[model samples]
Target: MARTTGSHSDITGPRVRAAALSLFAQHGFAAVSMRQIAREVGVQAGALYNYTPDKQSLLFDLMQTHMSDLLSSRDKLPETASPLEALETFTRFHIRFHSERPEEVFIAYMELRNLEPENFEAIEKLRRTYEDQLENILRAGVSEGVFKVADPKLATMAVIAMLTGVNTWFREGGRLSLEEVEQIYWDMVRKSVGA
Candidate 1:
């Protein structure tokens, strides 16, 4: 057994997840094998077992980690910030974060069918928690007469879908910088919310 130690083990997990996510996104989850993931991670097939019990567990871990990081980041927004400011913060964060981790975002959105029912439910719940934060901000804005949304929930989904779509087209060598992309998204989001 190749015993991974120290920071290497910690680094290996994310690297493996990233590789798995990219492969799974390119070739449907059902088409991927543990050996493939292990190879991509530059480890022996059996070595992957040291990081995750099985393929399903690996998928679950990826989604769970992404969602957890998302929620934690959103939760850190300043409490005194206005709903519009919060929305702006969310918009910028969503674009920048997703842009940097497109593979993870692609996996999270595309590999839902591969997870078992229990794992799927857990991931879905975490996703909703993040969505709810945006909805709550929209609702608060509407209540304060700062936003004019007909349905905060639907608007929340629309905004997120639009923002997340950025990862699909954004490239490191793209003409617009990440800051510019964020500003464009922030403008669209503000307009959509009537902020």
Candidate 2:
């Protein structure tokens, strides 16, 4: 099919993904269809093929982009002098980052079962890399005799699960501000690792 008049891939491509993300987050991957995404994007159903080969590919791309942005943002955080400081930074960062993108977080966690085997592996690798950052911090603290974690790996997962759990209950103007929530979580995390 010929390209739609006045349509640009640069602009429409992101709209397509955004629409898919929103729909997937709202209705789930198995329930959502490319035609629905195209309608949400204000394009014809067939137009979506210009951007993604299939719904599975679109889902994979959304997940991949989320993980990539997460890693990139995390890598930019300034280095800290001690494992204690690093752990604090990571605890706050994870809460802040995941909370801000609730839809992406929801889809990333909820839609994993829908991913194809290879895509699932790829996303899992990225998640492990992020988790490894926290694990390494726990390891460093253990080596320095600051953190009393019995198992750095277990502590990493626990801390991350605790931090990410904030998103499920957090709202912008609720009982606690995000900063306050961050501080509360930081304190819990510090004690969890015996820092």
Candidate 3:
């Protein structure tokens, strides 16, 4: 990677990344080009190399950043909270977080096939960590007889899929507020677990 020459590389670097992420989300990663990303960022083509080694690195950065934010944004549920409470918390969090970042969510799912093998594995690991949190909650519910989930792992995947699907057609003013969407999804999740 080339060292950034300009003092404004600090600002320019993020702008470059933002441009890359936006373009990658709109046009598939394979269809986008380094020069296009540079053009979007209003930088010379060579200048993009100062911020990233290659376009793949830019894609990896966007994916890793999104996963990191998803992992860190989850607050630990209260120690004394019941299984149902923990489940509700996870339901609401998944919906709210993914709904707020439609572009990131879209790219995260849509561009996984474009990732290099190692980058793909890293992203998958981070996603699995998030899945494990919900699976554990489901397991706790099953142990407590509060949920009749036959398979915690499958239930976790299903519930997450159902919740994340809200981003596809949900607009803020399109008949349902975000809170209502969250509540509706939460209710479906609650019933899905047989709680």
Candidate 4:
């Protein structure tokens, strides 16, 4: 079983989660089985049950972990940062993080439909938390006259959609470095808000 404490267990959970995330991303949740995930993780099929009770639980766990990591990482940013700084911080962090964990991003976005109704609601709540963070930054920028967006919520969704779309075409040897990509996105986002 994957324990909650210790470095060893910590590593195991992420490894299992990553394997599951990649599989789910490549094949929709309904098409993936515990055996498939175990094969990817190099464990016996039955051993997969040690980490999660069932397939739905595994999907929920993956989404929960991804959401929690995102929120926790965002929460670590400097609290007193300006609105523009906050948005930039979030944008840069998101771009870099998603680049490093494309499978998780894919699973988070695509496999949401596989969740049971209760699980879906819980995941949606966590998702809204992340969205609210972006909205908060946008609202702050509008309040301080640094940004001129008419609707912070709509603006937040637009920026997130544009930023997340990078995962679709981004390649390791692409012409643009991650920093350059982030800068391009930052420019577009800033201009979109009338910064």
User: Which segments of model 1 are wrong by more than 4 Å?
Assistant: 1-12
Misplaced by over 4 Å in model 4 are 1-15, 75-79
> Which model scores highest in lDDT?
2
lDDT of 3 by residue, 1-195 (tens): 666457578888789878887888788899999999989988889978888999889899999999999999996877999999999888889888998899899999999998999999999999999999999999999999999999999998899889889988999888989999889888889998998
**lDDT for each of the candidates?**
0.88, 0.92, 0.90, 0.85
TM for every model, in the order presented, reads 0.89, 0.94, 0.95, 0.88
Candidate 4, clashing residue pairs?
none
Question: Per-residue lDDT tens digits of candidate 4, residues 79-193?
Answer: 6789988988888887887888788888888888778899999999998999999999999999999999999999989989988889999998889888899999989888999
TM-score of candidate 1 against the unseen true structure? 0.89
Better of 1 and 4 by TM-score: 1
Q: What is the lDDT of residue 147 in candidate 2?
A: 93
Candidate 1 local Cα displacement, residue 194, angstroms: 1.4
Model 3 pairs whose backbones collide: none
For model 3, the stretches where C-alpha displacement exceeds 4 angstroms are 1-7
